[model samples]
Target: MGKTLVIDLEDVILEGDILDVGEKNFGIIYNISKEAEDELSLDYVSSDTKIELKERKYDACTFFFDLNKIWTSIEKEKLIKEISSYLKEFGEIFIWDINKERGKVFNNKIKVILPNEKIKEFTFRNLNVLLSSNIEEIKKILEKYFEIEETKAWEDVFFIKGKKIGTKVNEEEKIKYEGTDYSN
Candidate 1:
């Protein structure tokens, strides 16, 4: 099962270069799924690690903002839920979120906001991030829509992968991720 998962993820590539350590936005995906019986979980690995993935083909449709930077959390959650409805069962969603442990990076950040017809450069880190992409909070929401595979963090960003959990599975059920270069 471990080898199978490694084979399955050999083709995932994100927007940022995973190999570049300086690029804090991306990191290698790990197989953190627990064993049904007695299998081991594969945490995210790197080149210096015991195992390394060689091939990568990212089928990603990256959308950073739903409406804008100033949207409320309620609106964001609503949009995520709506989007979740359209996805096929067993489909996966990869998300990049701000890392709370890396909060120091935002210490000097500021933004412009409009409140009561007055413009003010204020708000939490200028991003007004809801829950600061908190993993537990994200889990609370995503768990309703997906069977979370794993959650991991890098320097300034954290990544989560979730597989849609359907009520039933059909032998013909299939979902494929398509990147910009995908060709049938």
Candidate 2:
């Protein structure tokens, strides 16, 4: 039986580059439904490391603050392995990246989970292309652990919060990401 995997991700994406290291706002939750499994449990083994950073902008004379910068890093391969291993025993896997905080500038960094698997050279365009065109490749890799349909999996991976909060599963929604271009 296939299980539904729900991933709640945070600033998991770095702007501009598309592919780079990603950080978690909190622990990723892998939720499976009753039709697939009765119970699910996961513990993040990575230690929490925090680093505080302050930056000042010229002209405007604005200062940036990151007081809760708990620096967290996990081996991309290891994270995938651990997650995949656990997912393999379930059904559909849902990956959700959410920007919990509302108004913090440069506050989204949740898409870095791929860097752990040696997947470099990422840009928003390519990532969106992969999401649309190369979904099978991603699905196969994901299938190694979970049972999810290619199309449906997209819903589980993307999230946005605003007046019109929703997933950017199409080309139009993805275009907005191009503005940043990973310089951050």
Candidate 3:
């Protein structure tokens, strides 16, 4: 079977109403917010793109841009659990987000021109979380279900790639994060 991949729709694929490199690749595009769902369509996206609404199984998933835009630490743990339920036993997950503190230093150098005011407004609110978010927390969440394969940072973006590591323990045990406080 072909590997299934899921991608965030906003900053990950569409940058200020313009399709980024991700739109050219095929996968199940997921819009966590209603506003994003309403704004995206095949009119602008590649014909290979398919918007996924229902919870479905996937082999690999990618979260580009920001995790804070999708969920909080506590909520993120829950989301990890939800993703685990649908992921194949040996599935992999990839995450890429702006390393807030580092990104700030080079923010001015990276400029993205929005197509219009509406798009500009949406992009601003959508990326607000990256300003104060710690990508390490997201890495911790993924560690519960997958083994860290690789982690690197380029300029301001931090990337993490993990492969599902099977354990003989119970599901709860497998998803538990020791010494990590997810209350935030």
Candidate 4:
């Protein structure tokens, strides 16, 4: 990937697909805000050296960000392989919260928090993208490189909504919350 503008779900839209499938606890909680920068203070990832913030250290470290790394009914290792190849040009890559304990280092290694409730796994990467402001501007900037394909999380939620079973919400739920619908 050449240039990418990563977005936090709560920052731009509702919650992002990444957090939905992530480990939850350590993934990175986001709140609704129209301001420039909020609590988490995340930023976007791009191809160029135009560093927006001074905290981004391009050292020999892996990048970890929320980018839809859930393995519910389908296998995500293949997706990770594809994305990993794309990230090789940039550097080592880690996604979501493969580990836990926010700033807590373990065994002298930068553990990647997976945000999972049951098990906390560690990876050798940190997050490269951390955008949390100006969605329209970020979208325009990202479209140049990443051919973002908008896909729903799980399809089984469509038939099992508000009932007793599936908590999964389909496009209809998204429409109800977004106040607008898109051509799916």
Best by TM-score: 3
Worst 10 residues of 3 by lDDT: 115-124
Local distance difference test scores for all models: 0.39, 0.26, 0.48, 0.27
Instruction: Assess candidate 3 and give its TM-score to the true structure.
Output: 0.49
Candidate 3's residue-wise lDDT over 78-109, tens digit each?
A: 75665555556766666656555423322222
Q: Name the best candidate (by lDDT).
A: 3
Clashes of each: 2, 30, 0, 21
Those runs of model 2 whose alpha carbons end farther than 4 Å from true positions after fitting are 1-23, 26-42, 47-78, 97-137, 150-184
lDDT of 1: 0.39
In terms of lDDT, which candidate is stronger, 2 or 3? 3
lDDT of 4 by residue, 27-120 (tens): 3323221132333333333434233323333211112333322322123334333333332222322222222123432122222221222223
Candidate 1 lDDT over 32-151, as tens digits, reads 112111333322223363233223312221222112232345665675565454444455666645444222223222222222232222222323434244455566777776777888
TM-score of each: 0.41, 0.26, 0.49, 0.19
**Alpha-carbon deviation at 168 in model 1, angstroms:** 10
Q: What is the lDDT of residue 29 in candidate 2?
A: 26
